[model samples]
Target: MGPTGDGGGDGAGLVVIIVLAAAAVVSLLVAFGYYCYIRNKVSKHLNKLKRNNEALEKARSAVEEEEEGEVGPTVVTERGVQVFGFKQLHSATGGFAKANVVGNGSFGSVYRGVLPEGRKVAVKLMDRAGKQGDEEFKMEVELLTRLRCPHLLGLVGYCSDNGHRLLVYEYMANGGLQEHLYPDGGSCGGVSKLDWETRMRIALEAAKGLEYLHEHVNPPVIHRDFKSSNILLDRNFHAKVSDFGLAKLGSDKAGGHVSTRVLGTQGYVAPE
Candidate 1:
């Protein structure tokens, strides 16, 4: 009887130990599952935040691009002249560096620049304190926008921003006739001297340009500052009349002359 009782006690102890070990294992598995759930939740949250940040950045870039496209004011006229943004011109001329300077006049300086489309252009940067006033600037823009002739310089665009006035024109490779006629230690010195035939051709082209302005246009234009320096030549030696800041509008009637202030070069002015 004693042996049987002892055997029963031992069996009970073994059963208890086995149950406790099984409980410990079950607890460990539950803890591991909970940890995995929490880790997965945190990973999903981080991925959502990353996607939202990328979306926000894309939206900001779109707004910036829209603003860049709308830099200058809109023009209602259908003329060929474009209204350029100040920033675009600034970048084109390399911040208006001195090395890009092609010529200088009493009004301002001209710079050689390349447009974004790889087109070369001449940018005339008007001096704020120079002889040209706002009125003259407006007059030149108005006339150049309307006048279109083979022998006349073409107006590409203009910019009026932050009290800065600039005119954009087609690049004249050969420069002005004055440089060829009289070598004055200028950038156009490397150009060969003009022969008699070339000089006559230039004169004829200049005459044709003046005739178109005086006769063809309804309100005839009088280029008050016509001189050799104002006549630009292309690479092919084709002459084009430029610099219409002092241009005047004459009457359409016959024998009508528009009288204005006496403003022209000393030697080029006609005797009254």
Candidate 2:
């Protein structure tokens, strides 16, 4: 040993080394904690992003469901359903002239019209004489939009523009069952094309249509205006239920049902 002071200096250096080592360990621990914090944040952000993407996908699917088939609120396009313009229907029905009138009913006169794509259609211009109100017209459109059945009349489209309420329907080549069953003025007296077998078939098909509304649809639909004139026929005499001016949505199943008013054909009315 050189000097006693050298021992003191060595002791001081050892203590400094120990302190430095402790500081380094603490720094490493702090770095690890910061890394863990950053990782946790990134994981949370990813989870949130995943949830957002799932929500977006679900929304897209719901939109696709509503837009399924030919359903939209605009005309102009050749589709299974539409919301037509007043001008378009006016032109199609020859300005609602007398010549285009095919049949007259409690709602209004039915007119034959040809769409731009050469598609034959029947346009029923709701009578402005207060027989049909806005609520009834809107309800009919809403129900037809949701209701789709083979035996039930298909609502091709409608027009609620320019203070006018008109419904567009698929042109039934055979016309109304009434027209074929009981012809007026000319083809009177005898049995028309509707034979006994055909009449039975028509009756079955019509019942099926009504059954669909009663059992299939939720809350059920009441065709308050069920009648022979409301039954239309295809080219093959296949009957489909048409017209829903006085249709009503039923209440709870347990409570049965109540009619707000009696508005159907007097003779055809179901005697309560």
Candidate 3:
């Protein structure tokens, strides 16, 4: 009887050992599955963050370019038609190089660039973010395409690409009237003397240009931001109005007096 009892006790101990071994194997499989799940989740989250960062960087670059007055390729004249190539303008302006900047205004920066054809031109760069700029670019193209007058600033051409808007014009040798009137590091009290005859001629010539904009065109144009700075002169001192960013066409058809948020240089702005 004692021998039979010992054998049964040994058999029971063996069964218990097998049960524990099976439980250990099950635990290991469960742990491995959980680890895989966590690893996949972490990988997915990291990828998402990377994509978001790239998008944010692109947005920041666009804003910075606009604020700093940096623009992309400008348009220019090719024969009688307005034309521009991404590669050509890029090379001409030294990749819109910062060193080429000659002037700046409310609209954008002016770069003095030499074309592939060896023509010197003034490139006016505009901000792509603002609706005001977009409207100005469209209006200039449409209005200039239709009108032809010597007193007005000639639009050689324009470029609309890569979120950049630019206007190209024949470079003025003498620069704008404001530059002559208000030389840097000089007191305004001693502004450059404009003789009576010269001033009178300028007034008349500009008046005729305004008359053309107001009376002759199918839809009258109003130069909202008229100032000495906008009055550019060539080598012969011939006056032609520049900076049409605030110019509007068809003032007659505009709704309810069309009030604009105040624009132009402080001293040059017209009183409402």
The C-alpha TM-scores of every prediction are: 0.70, 0.67, 0.63
Across 1-272, the per-residue lDDT of candidate 3 in tens digits comes to: 99999999999999999998899989998999999999999999999999999999987886676444454433334334365544456667787789988778667788888876788888877764678778888877777766778889887777776777877888888777777777673545456766778777777877778888888876687787787777888877788887666777665664536555776677777677
- Segments in model 1 whose C-alpha atoms lie over 4 Å from true places: 1-77, 130-132, 185-192
Worst 10-residue lDDT window, candidate 2: 69-78
TM-score of 1: 0.70
lDDT of 1 at 97: 94
Instruction: Order the candidates by lDDT, highest first.
Output: 1, 2, 3
Worst 10 residues of 3 by lDDT: 72-81
Model number with the top lDDT: 1
lDDT against the true structure, per candidate, is: 0.87, 0.83, 0.75
- Candidates arranged by TM-score, highest first: 1, 2, 3
State the TM-score for model 2.
0.67
Q: Is candidate 2 or candidate 3 better by TM-score?
A: 2
In model 2, residue pairs whose N, Cα or C atoms come closer than 3 Å (at least 3 residues apart or on different chains), thus clashing, are: none
| Residue 221 shift from truth in candidate 1, angstroms | 0.3
For all candidates, what are the clash counts? 0, 0, 0
> How does residue 10 of candidate 1 score in lDDT?
100
